[model samples]
Target: MKILKNIILISLFLTVSSCQKWLTVEPEDRSTEDQLFSSVNGFYIALNGIYTDFTNPYSYGAAWTMTTLEILAQRYNVNQEHTSYTLANYGFQEETAKRTMESIWNKAYFQIASANNILEQIEKRREIFTSPVDYALIKGEALALRAMIHFDLVRLFGPMPAQGGDNAAIPYYIENNRKTAPILSLNQVLSKAITDLENAIELLKEDPIISKGPLYSDSQLGGDYQRRYRTLRLNYFATLGLLARVQLYAGNKPSAFQHAATVITQASTWFPFIKTENIMGSSKNPDRIFSTEILFSLQAPQRQQTYLAYFAPDLDGKNILAPLSSRLDQSFENNQNDFRYTPLWASGEASGKNYRVFSKYNNIEDSRLNYNNRIPLIRLSEMYYIAAESAENPNEGLTFLNTIRNARGLVSLSELAPEQWKSEIEKEYIKEFYGEGQLFFFFKRIGKATIPDGKSVNNINMTPSKYIVPLPESETRHRN
Candidate 1:
């Protein structure tokens, strides 16, 4: 095994110096700072490389971002045939589960180290950048990426926000070094992450993509817009959107509400909700991660087979990873008109017979939508929910809730009593982010138990302690 200390010391800056090939991770170099920050395009290449990490199967690409979180949320059926039996059964102690957890943990810190190296080198060779805007853009994104990775690490391994401010959490590694910084409390990590994002927002305001409309190729630095797919990268607005999520997770309800509301209003032009007309009877891949509903996403290439390996009925006779039909039925609550219902979950009987397979991560070959198996991390509807949940007045909160309901083709209901708002929000959360892996965080945020199982009623309340996955054995075995 590579020394954990050594792994934390180097950068991921590799070979293959093509800007178009930014998404690919073919590194000929050992990822030294001088080699990566050699010129203007080098910074661009390094920044784009971070997004590539999101597609790694060990990290956000599959395990931590989608499948594992879905399993933890009890969003799927639990059976021997399902791949998530260990996770759903709360098998954190098992060797396989620990290895999975360790891979995610290790991969996250590796990227964090890269981000740190990039930021340091950007400052060291400040004159190398032809302009200030490029410097700021690269640095801002690096800061946000570091904070984002650390934030997820904390949520996965740290205590819930409701557990109070003083609980020990994940270590925040800012420097590209072998020395591990001491772990801070949950409150500290949240504060540090917010600070980083705030700095990022200031620099990203000058994001050329925002003004250029789309990418264009040219000789000058500012003229090139080939990689301006802002949605895929954490652009300025997406950074703001992420701030809303971080704020909510930190238990700052008012701040979360305000940030989310801003994104809903300002980012609407870029991420308008999918129109009902385009969604129905379309062979295109607009409904999934590649859809307009996405605020931030990951470009996961060659993932179609991964989807087929688990969800495709004909390919795998012993398919392991699906939900109970009863659980899915109740999740939709028997609303056939709901737009989110039909596209995301269809009968397993379509290919085989029995459980409901996840269709959200399906890779689509739509040249029209530019769909290519992207993985969405944040969506527009989440803002509405954040605003709704954090709103003070019952009518105010209900208005936000109704907006999404109406969009999904469900009839809008009148304002419910104030006490019912939480459950109302819960219902939307279930439907809005089913396979997207958000339910666990929702539960952790609100101390929600009695989660949806095979049956809606008479199910055991999920134990509170299970919400926090244990520190990986690699950390425990090696830590001072």
Candidate 2:
């Protein structure tokens, strides 16, 4: 395996006043009406900073916590038997995980503060961005990002109390230097998220063009391809795709279905799925629905170390004959044509343990770092899945599900009823998006009954509440 590593060392802290720049203005270092937003370069810097914030390990906190949370949650479900992560071994409630959860909560709010600051500055000097189209585009992107961070905070930490939620989620800070607020109920938190997304969708509609410059090229068409790059930019469709996902999670099915359908209809005009052949080996494939098949991936220039801790026993290179062996064996039972089994499974006499390597995330070659593979924040496939699940008609939902499965070379199940079909659809999700962090949401949304981990059959107990993770002790401390 070729491990590609590129280090794009970025300053972690955003001390807005630290840099000396050509543009300087007013009372709070806020730009003037005739200043920053008037020029294209200023807009670029602001947008770049937002992108940087999203990818920062500390700033947004999605990369580390989201991925880890997904792995733990999925394993909790599939390998409930102590044979894998036994109750004796299950320690997500441990002090270490608690601290990590705290960091994630803090990091999310920090990035939101940055996004809010940008929006505030732009609004303060609205005249500089004379064209309403340009103004709305920038504002919309910021709102979308803000909404995303808020939704994550609610999902990971618990509901927010800002808009009157009683569950008391993490504090909602809409203003810069704002004090933390009391927790809100999940419903209230989601309501605010829905509002933000609606506003964002409207704003982004005013501007359709999105690109900084050329990322790569097979041949030079004009002056500098690098300076004319458009392929790497995130446009309106990408933003809407995320909106659909967040809305769906919040239980706004109609809104979710609408946005998702819009994305599906415009997909070819915006982005297409990578051809199966291209996806296998071609690293430069751009058929991904979004700029990177990643709405907000961690922009690590080079991966120095494998994130093996999140890997299943089947995938981890360090663990020999670990607990994941049996799980993989059982997971693939009777499945012959599943492509995931090959790249993600291992079984042979050459090694004592039947280990499977998840090549999906295995970026061994260093050159791949030039393109960030942090963790996909959102993808077109997810939008498609959301559309399927949110479809008002059960039959239509089945069609959407089959379309995606066919693309991945999986069999289509059409005989099942709506209720039965839902369960099967979720199972497909577990198999397809395994390590992609969609598993937990699936369980939560579907309210799947949890099975126990043990040797005795009588020990099994089903509980839906378990799917909603308990708020970390640290988060609770900040609540009251």
Candidate 3:
């Protein structure tokens, strides 16, 4: 029965199928409007649906936003033949690259649109929210999501004016619009995002409970209903994490530090880091800190399968992907002691051929079953990095860096002068968070070295102008 449920649920979710009649919203159809936000309970359902959209690969889920954009930046595996990105890496301008970059912008706004709907519905019933906890949780999550979307936009495109005229920020679309909106300057967009996140933090100060009451909980209630609620979900910590990240990106370093510090100080109980031993499958493997480290996580029923394609070796295909020789050559050359290469990759010559592959995401339940791991959107590792970066001194940053490195069984550095220690911080960040989507932005934010791949310039120099991406074509549609 569970297998049947999994099959039905995955079929419905993993594809870009047409919307079901029940899920469609028509402008004139206020039929279910009352039920949509009638109670706090209804608002929770709407919010859950918004989060659900984020997990789709075409959206912010792992396979797309997290993976593709992260290839040039360390923290992801890349095949040599990805010419689309190869073009970007080598400084080639291509339409497909533009589309790929714009895809993240489009999808983030789509999620924001869904969130806007929830916020609009909730505002109509603002009078009913009796406790601060109820009032804050709904509004807080919406604000956080809005800020997150806008922050992504600003990071991609530069600032827009705060005003609403031809110069106003990226349409500050509190109200959803089906039509194209004008672009805002990078400054204006980030300003609004910061405001929204700040407001969310205030509301969530009561630390609202996430498991029950108005929100849907993962009831072991068997069947599609259970699958629907379990994999993609968000709670308070996720909201706070988004706020911290946005503040950091916006150059409000103090604010960024404080917000991150607040989460560390207050939410520690909820989202503790997995001990180092636990990361590599020692002790009972917690589900990638979904309950806590991930204040909110993007979900996909096929996450396990997708992860293996990149992280795991293709043992079935005679080890075609992630060849062992290459892994060893890169990670274990010149007497380097990185165990991730030695223990993680396997190399063998079978049938007169040398094959290499990864084993990180390989454990399958059955011969024909799908892997069901949820991707971690926010983790303690990230928070620790954030905390370290936000610190004013090298020593302070190194403490956090060493915490992560030592946990992974790597040697920790100590007793270095500030000038020398600065490079140490960079080294730890690149090595520790590799493939976790921190490279490009970190390079931009900190003004790091630029490594030219081909024609595309992948942050070979950290120029301030390069900090934000250009506006999407849709955003500039009304400009001219």
lDDT of each: 0.73, 0.53, 0.51
Q: Report the lDDT of model 3 for residue 400.
A: 69
Among the numbered candidates, top TM-score falls to: 1
Runs with alpha carbons beyond 4 Å of true place in candidate 2? 1-43, 56-66, 76-93, 130-134, 159-166, 206-234, 280-298, 302-304, 308-323, 329-336, 344-352, 364-374, 451-480
Relative to the unseen true structure, what is the Cα RMSD of model 3? 8.1
Question: What is the TM-score of each predicted model, taking all chains together?
Answer: 0.90, 0.74, 0.72
What is candidate 1's lDDT per residue for 1-480, written digit by digit as tens? Answer: 121322222234333223334444344656555665688787776777777777777777777656788778876665655556777777888877888888888898888877887887788899887778888888888998988898888988888877886998888887776775777999999999999999999998887656543232333345354246666677777788789899999989899989888887777776667887666656555455426777777766546656876666564533446666777778889887888877776567766667666777775555334445667788888999999988777678788889999988888878687678888889898888865767888888787766766323336476646788887876766574
1 or 3, which is superior by lDDT?
1
Candidate 2 lDDT by residue in tens digits, 1-480: 011111122243332221112112222354542454556446645555556655444432234333444444543232433223422233446665455555666556656766676676677677776667667766777787777778866765563222234565555555654455556677777777777777887886654333321233424334332122222223466678877877776677899999999877765444554455544444443222223334334443322234443333433333221224445545554464555455444343343434453434444343333243444556667777888888888888888888777766677867557568676666566666644556656655555556323222222343433443456565565555
Worst 10 residues of 2 by lDDT: 1-10
Order of the predicted models by TM-score, top scorer first: 1, 2, 3
Clashes of each: 6, 30, 26
**Candidate 3 lDDT, tens digit per residue, 1-480?**
000100001112334212121122222333365755666655655665666666666555643334554553433223355443442343313576567656666676667776777677677788776755666666777787777766655544543222221333355666654554445555667677778877776776655333331122333322323113321334455666677787676666677777676666666665555443444453233222322344455545565566565555433332133323433353333223543443343444442436444443333343222112445556555666677777777677778677766654677777567676546656655544433455555565555555333222232553443434555675565466
Worst 10 residues of 1 by lDDT: 1-10
